[model samples]
Target chain A: MADLPERVEIAEEGPREGFQIEPGPIPTADKVALIDALSATGLRHIQVCSFVNPKLVPGWADAEAVAAGFSPRGGVRYAALWFNENGLKRALAFRDRLSITGSVSLSASDAFSVKNLNRDHAANLDAMRRMTAVHKAAGVPVTRVGVMAAFGCNYQGDILPEQVVRTVADGLAVAQEAGETIADVSLADTMGWATPTRIERGVGAVRERWPHLRIGLHLHDTRGLAVANAHAGLRLGVDRFDSTVGGLGGCPFAGQKGAAGNICTEELVLLCEEMGVRTGVDLDALIEVGRMAERIVGHALPSELLRAGSLDAFRRKQAA
Target chain B: MADLPERVEIAEEGPREGFQIEPGPIPTADKVALIDALSATGLRHIQVCSFVNPKLVPGWADAEAVAAGFSPRGGVRYAALWFNENGLKRALAFRDRLSITGSVSLSASDAFSVKNLNRDHAANLDAMRRMTAVHKAAGVPVTRVGVMAAFGCNYQGDILPEQVVRTVADGLAVAQEAGETIADVSLADTMGWATPTRIERGVGAVRERWPHLRIGLHLHDTRGLAVANAHAGLRLGVDRFDSTVGGLGGCPFAGQKGAAGNICTEELVLLCEEMGVRTGVDLDALIEVGRMAERIVGHALPSELLRAGSLDAFRRKQAA
Candidate 1:
């Protein structure tokens, strides 16, 4: 009980994740509206856009437009995800507008690294080294180490705690060689294969090995256990999480199976607030944004709270 | 860790919950087919149908047809829900095939009792007393006491632990006065207002008061925290749960927001199996049944596992 954190930081990734996955030629103006609305929801960290090749991810082909259009709120850090120098250079164009910290992202499963990144774990470390050097030369701080498929993988089966430890160790070693001071390490359940037990073991291993570094969880609700997994993280004293409003980025609940988006930001905020943990988020306002995201996407996203509403909303009604 | 149950029972309530809520005149054959298919998936307890007034729940108008239609498998207990003596008499007609034990049902929230049950707590207790005597007269055992809105209520706001204990005690008193030996108590998150912390405190308080009685959770995902609340129950070693296949009773994901179904049966199975708790359920078979339910309902249900496939299914694919 004492392990629960006093407050947690929920980083919003709806725009970056949702636009990248939706198979729509969504108007750039709507994308900008989403970012602007999320900004007003008291979310401090919002990933605004993904700077990827337009030819491959046509949904986000107008990443530059979305990057340039939204009104950024003060005290909120707007981020852009880029895989290579090309994307980073494009992001550098908006250096004054975006909070551009670089992350040394690696995959815990060698098979997932080979399948997703087209590189093995060793090769991926080399790539990270090069990317770290690029960020250092460009005066961008690379202070967060991220591990994809940290819980389990589609290509590789169940991931062990020792495997998670070795992956984070590799990322930290890379940072050491690059003279980068890593402030936090984030674990991504890229395949939606995490259970509460796995979260306890995986996060426990990382924390035991690196007690000084802050731990973050990036969970996917591929199998409807994201909320449970988040509760497990909260119980373990993890205070940082990355989520998407309306569970954006995964296949819409009605469209397909097997791919679920990130944990709905409003749901996570509701869970935290109900447990008396300060989330710094107005859950009702966030739920409204979730509804707005659903409207923009032209589908019902996988957020139950967006439909039923926050408990407090009902409480207020009852009080009235 | 020691508190986790080694094995748990997940009772399927899809056909009853889903049909009652779905606007469709879902075919009687489809309801029977769902029940039959779920029996094959190793779920021991299946709520086959609801014997309510046809005008009130037209969806379950053919409860008798479903009750008599499905082939009841050995080792599986088919159950039916009813409210008044008429509904109980309807269920009694199929007593040869259905599990005929009765439950003394009450609501913890006075506001919910008045709004939902159309009676105050004191009045409702009198109604339950009459119902218990009716069950006793019919040679039926009233062994379970169910408290709805046991966690919180939309009309009444938060529910205190002591309130839950009082509600259960009232139900138990009604049963004892009628010579009923209650064996278990179920605390329902009737309005989807329960959190993990509440589950712990509520269930914990009940266990402290009645250590001999088995505790069951009947949770709703109306607010998307059902799985987390279930986990909280598992942590407290509460071994029984009531869930719906494909999240049957709740509103469809894309159709509406707040009125989501029960904690998904497959998701609960996945959680239990992943945590090394025995559920005796074939998860892949259950997922297939969930898909079939979607096909019958002609829409997507709120189960992410129904789409993402189970971890074992992927494991098999990876192995193959």
Candidate 2:
């Protein structure tokens, strides 16, 4: 096997993308401790909180407090997620201390968007453009912009790859006008309905059009194909991924509970390690963090590696 | 899409292969009910019980009584599993009413053989040869003889495909000498460690060497690749399969408790249906049987289709 890269950058999504979709509200201190422990794990980027309204998403009610209290390490780059101008204003409060990123949901099904986000695709794009302009004027960098639901939607059967390419093109045009550096472009399987073929086609289309764009994939394991899809993406030269520790996130609209945890970070790391891809994260330490998260959440987290441990660890136990 | 083939023939393995490795003894009444329900599901071939020693496998202590008391169905061919000359005698008691199938563990792994059946490979083959001689003397036909651990073993990583082919050849020679017809030769992944590529290679090897032999596949879903491997086998022209309802079987020696149920029957049927391969199994009815088995077992079974329902059913709910 070829040697792995020296350092692979993994962006943590547990705080923003993970916690925002969780049903009940988790305490601010507990969330802070979770983030703190995660920060110490050698992760280059950690999306600590989202600036959405507390009334809209009660799970992230402590977003501002959590953002302010985070103890940033020397090498860690903390980031926050924002939706529109108002959320961007809230996110800018921590701009001097941490990086800020913007995101928008681009649903293949208009019904899902109107029902879940209360806005259609065009309206969401318009809001993103205005937010980008405001961030540019304030001299805060819009590090990343993501397009969610690039794969098939729950309400709609198959999402065309062309639609995703067009959406990414439109987002790029908007980012250009705002004079913002488009740090990364991400495609999300928001409903966990993506197959490996669909991921390959969609990511391939984006890579073909935007060769220089740093691509990331956010997937859900609703159909037990998340890891397979992630592997497919990795083969296509897309490295950065968004994973919740212990598979914490779910689509509130889909209504399937415990839909397999976010591809299990330990499992992904193991796969990468076996394939000679450097992740720069310790498997044992990540498993410990998963267990800690399970205790804090008052429920068993859906991570398989925590229970199974690493294969090497298993072999070591047998030898002993 | 091409139309599905008519009259699908499946070999039900709940009684012998399913419960053989179960840690705790399942009640005879429950076992009897499971067989009756399985018979009612239009399965033409059912391996109802095994004639191994009760001391070796206490789970099959009531095998004779259960086999004797089972209500005979006209078209369904009930069979008993026999391991040696002693087991053949026990199987002969039910020979007039049902077909008798004998099995020999032809694994390359001595450790797995000792752990599973308390015999080495050479000893098991010798026992099978002697058993075949007895069946020939009685003018009874041996319905099936299987080569276990054909692809890979949990105890010993990779088993040579040639070893499997040679074992089948030896078993066939013994049956020919005894004047007993070898109705089918099965390749079993008793430890559930075979991948799709391995399935193609192993099954392809068997088919190429013995084109006249009726081939079968017995798979376990220990690593979530059972269905994919089964698909590979189907593509390789091996039709007969051994699947327990709700994938309810595990190897006692494998050391993992409650490994994911056999490649879930409902999931298998759904895949076959979508792929235009005829299994002649009702998806909805199979789900009902799976639920019944789950109830008898006093625990939820590991069938994804039972929880998710059929795709047609889901589409109906969406329309409703």
Candidate 3:
């Protein structure tokens, strides 16, 4: 309905975001195979793993091995999520893109911050600054500073738009002071509270504050608005999005069960394609990869495209 | 994003479309209770049930009893679906609004017509004309002419926009010849194959042909684009949408299972509310009604809103 972006970049996060909350352990070989299958589908960027504590997230215990085992394809960026200097050091060994994760709305709800990060608001900000400086010194090619709970906090009902702008501004100022050229600043809907209007407003506020910084959306399909919110972002000229295969991942911090997860990769691509936006993805291949992910996960996924198939799915049945 | 309509109307079809496909027979009192619950949620229009053959849709065996049992609330329109003279006569016993169903793309794919209606294209049109003549003689107050598979067909991949326009023209001519003033003409995506661009193009074509006619959309969330396509239609100024509580109903004729169903009522309302579009339906009450429907139907529904709860679902959890 609106003027869509010519093309959008899909960042695969199933291996990292989706797998982190899964109670069952996924073998490193399987993770690598999943990433490889995703790479073959022409996905240009994949967050293959996260460098977090093995005890905290058992699913990501072999993050380093998964990263080391991945066969990088040309033009595809392999990235990892890091929370502290140790995680960053582990990620630096094999990372093309490194992410420093923090929630900008930590101050809005201290209860969530304590449960989610085990740190207070000021401590989280200080850690974010220190992490940004360390990443700058390492001189990684691409660094994404993610502001989780940017749209709404789980403990906090409705986040004020000004708080998001302030967080982005302060984060950008810290990164700039460290002489780091930030590649992207992501707005993470950790609890899936983002609506289209909220997404538009949040994106608008960030763009107004830091017009030069590239913005990305890391959305969850908790209330079935991930794709809709993604569309809203696209209308506002956002081109980069984080999605998980088979709509995997749960919000451990929010104590959410298997209800809400990352936006499904195939579903997002289909949304863009149906809206006449180019995603540079092979839908059929992506669906196949999604099926492989679902099988490996040992359960049915939340993706509609994977379940419904393509528009031509019934052609053969009808012909027969 | 885009400028949304100031307000939109949601027509609840849980009792008719949702129940028709449910294999397990629901008690007449349960269906009545579900409709009564929905009516209390400020939903002004509810398609209570259809007057189709009880043998055809065993789930709707007590349609007339359900209609008789419902306590009609003020400002709510209780409607029924009717196909032929017998069904019309049944509906006429307590008529509010009647639907005359046929696809605009019937000629494009006779296989679908035969499978869905047990009649070919020409025969379906002739039946539609005859039905319209009978409706004129009975002098029903409101009649909705539905064009099933207006965007895409299960039998034939993509139905052209021109075919839809021609069907509407022909259907309108028949109704006019019979001296019956049609209240609404709806584009029904029975197989959930409608896309956003296709929806925009189809709605535009119909508007160009019949500028004065009230256009409505009957969408299925099979590919999860029902909401997106609804948004597209909203952008083109089509406001009336057919939704079911808990996103119930599967297409029995198309042989689809658990994929294509009516757009979930609460989710649609949430989408509209988030986009600054006003829907008078109460979200909390509607979600409760959805849960009641789920309980009576004895299964988990496809509604994300019901699963995710409301935006404030975590407030109590956090407090505890």
Best prediction by TM-score: 1
The DockQ-derived docking category for candidate 1 is medium
Encode model 3's per-residue lDDT on A1-320: one tens digit a residue.
56678899999988888777767788888899999999999898888888898887788889878887888888887877777778878877764543333322234344456667789767777876776666666765435556778888777767767887777666666666666656688888878888878987888988887788789998988887787788778878899999998888865544455476888898889888767788888888898999899898898788877777766456666567
Off by over 4 Å in 1: A251-258, B251-258
- Candidate 3 residue pairs in clash (backbone atoms < 3 Å): none
Go through the candidates in order and give each one's C-alpha lDDT. Answer: 0.90, 0.69, 0.78
lDDT of 2 by residue, A37-67 (tens): 8877766778898888888878878888999
Separately for all candidates shown, the number of backbone clashes (residues 3 or more apart, or on different chains) is: 9, 2, 0
Which DockQ values do the candidates obtain, in the order shown?
Answer: 0.65, 0.16, 0.51
Compared with the true structure, the alpha-carbon lDDT of candidate 3 equals 0.78
Q: How many clashes in candidate 1?
A: 9
What TM-score do all the candidates reach, one by one? 0.97, 0.76, 0.92
Q: Is candidate 1 or candidate 3 better by DockQ?
A: 1
Residue ranges of candidate 2 with Cα displaced over 4 Å:
A1-49, A64-80, A89-99, A134-151, A158-187, A196-217, A228-241, A254-261, A269-293, A298-309, A317-320, B1-82, B85-99, B131-247, B269-285
Candidate 3 residue runs with Cα over 4 Å from true position: A95-115, A253-255, A312-320, B96-111, B253-255, B312-320
lDDT of 3 by residue, B69-185 (tens): 989888888877767789878877775533333222233356678877789878888887777667667765435567887887777777878988887777777777776666678
- For model 3, the chain A TM-score is 0.91
